[model samples]
Structures are given as structure tokens and as C-alpha cells.
Target: MKVGLYFGTFNPVHIGHIIIANHLAENSELDQIWMVLTPHNPLKKKAGLLEDYHRLHMVHLATEKFEKIQASDIEFKLPQPNYTINTLVHLEEKFPKHEFSLIMGEDNLKGFHKWKNYEAILAHYHLYVYPRISESTIPEQFKDHPHIHKIEAPVIELSSTFIRNNIKEGKNIEPMLPEKVWEYIDHNLFYRK
Candidate 1:
């Protein structure tokens, strides 16, 4: 099986996220897209992130109806400050039968060189980069990476931060998030000030 690892905190999974996953699954050669719930990302902001359990549950809710998508907590069991390269190594060892590829935004693709063991990652695994709102740009040196491919994602401007802010401000967010996920957030008081 060819699985695309879509890693993120996903404080609360939004419609935009669902769209991207579906778009990739339908368009790419991937058989499935795992929404890897990262407990703590080494490269992202943590100040506004909800608890990992909360995030994971929300992802599970959002993707419940889609067999092509999965809510993975692999990073939750790993040590703190998760690194992509290490996570890839672990997944490869654990699921030897399946081939794992990365699913990231084009913006992240430009910074691949800064990541730990990036050279090894490029050499060993395939990358499926989707376009973010930012311009899709790859550094010249990385243009020839053997196993890299860029994909065009669906047009959805909504982000997790925006949803969280709407909830905190007592604004309507039901339209922006998956119904199950919105219910979970409201029931648990997630992102409430």
C-alpha cells in the first residue's frame, strides 16, 4: 500500500483539511492518506495548540466516514519535540509491508534542507507536496531530489487558527468545521477563552 503521511497538529480538523486530504487521495497515486496527529511538532508554534488527545479525537471525528483517511497518533507515542525524519524511520520499521510517503505543503518543501536527516529522508522516502496559499517554491539545490513530487490541492482558505479564533470569539464556526468535530469542540470547550 502506498500511504501519504499528512502530518499536523490539527487543533480541530476543519473542512479545508478534509478537502486537501480527499483531493490528494483522489488525484495522487497514493492509496490512502494518514492524518498523522503530531503531539508536538519540532518546527511549528505550540502556544495555541490544543492537547494532543483533543486534536486526535477531532481528526478521528472528521475522517470517520472516509476509509481512505486515517487518524494516526504515531507521533503521540514518540518522544517529545517530534522530528519528521525520526517519525518516518519508525513508521518504516513498524509497517514494513506498506510504503510511506510525505504529504506536505509547498512552503514546507522549500525548507526541507533545514530538517534533521533531511538528506537521508530525501534519499529514502517519497514526498508528495501540495500547494499552500503561499507561492509554491522549491530551492534550486533540491529541485532534483529523486523522490519528490508536487501536487495541487483544492482551494480552501480556512485554517485551524481561524476556526479556533471564531470559537473563542463566540462566532459561528459550525459551517467551517466537520459536524462531528464541531460537536466535539463545543462539548469539550476546546479553544475557549
Candidate 2:
């Protein structure tokens, strides 16, 4: 199977994430899109981040109905301070028959060169980038790279932080989240700090 790994902390999975993942799954040649839930991202601060399982459960809630998209807890089993390179290598070994690609936003592309063994990643796997509202330009070297495919997906500006903040302030973020996810958060009182 051709799978695109869409990695995220997914503190609280929302509609924007679902929209982008679904867009790639339906519009691109990818057979499946795995929403890999990361336990901890090296570049991000830990504050306000939900526990791994809570985040994973929300992802499951958000993607349960989508046949082409599924939630993965693959990173949770790996070592902490996870890096994309390590995860990619592990996935390749675990699923030799499957071709794995990356699903990322245009904003991430600007810092792609700084990732661990980024050159190796480019050499081994194709990157499918969706549009994002960002001011940074993609590096010159990656502009026309064969391994990088810029998908003309919709630009979703919504974010988990925005949803969390609104919920904390007693605002209705129901429309910003998937129905099941919204219910899960409402029941558990998540992100209402």
C-alpha cells in the first residue's frame, strides 16, 4: 500500500486536520493516509500538550469514519523526543512491502533542510506538501526537487491551539471539531484550562 504519514501532536484533533488529510487521500495518488500521533516532538514545547493516549483517542474519534484515513499510535512506541528520520526508518523495516511518503504543510517545507538526515529522507521517500498560510519561502534547493510534490490542496488555517484557547474561554468551538471529537472533548472537559 502507498501510505502518506501525516504526523502531528493532535492535542485535540479538529476539522482542519480532517479536511487536509481527507483532501490528500482523495485528491492524491496515495492509497492511505496515516495520522501518526507523536508522543513528543523535539521542536515543540511540552506545555499544554495532552497525554499521548488522550491525543491518540481524539485522533481516532476524528478519523474513525474515514476509510482512507486512520489514526496511528506508532510514534508512542518509539523512543521519546521522536525524529521523523527514525520513524521513517522503523516504518520501512516494519512494512517492507508498503511505500511510505510524508504529508506536510507548506510552512514545514521552509525548515525541511534542518531536519535530521533530511537529505537521506528526500533520497528515500517522497514528500507531499499541502498549502499553508505562511510567509516563509521554501528553500531554493527544494524548489524543484523530484522527491518533493507540492499538492494543490486547500489551505486550512485553523489550528488546535486556537480551538483550545476558545474552549478555555467558554466559547463554542463545536464547528471547528469533528462531531465525535467535539463530544469527546466536551465530555472529558479537555483543554478547558
Residue 141's lDDT in candidate 2 = 94
All candidates: CA RMSD (Å): 2.2, 1.6
Give the per-residue lDDT digits (tens) of candidate 2, residues 112-139: 8899999999999999998889798999
Q: Among these predicted structures, which one has the highest lDDT?
A: 2
- For model 1, how does the per-residue alpha-carbon lDDT over 69-146 read when each residue is reduced to its tens digit? 999999888887778998998998999999999988878877788999988888888998777777657899777767
Error of 2 at 132 (Å): 0.5
What TM-score would you give candidate 2 relative to the actual structure? 0.96
TM-score each candidate: 0.92, 0.96
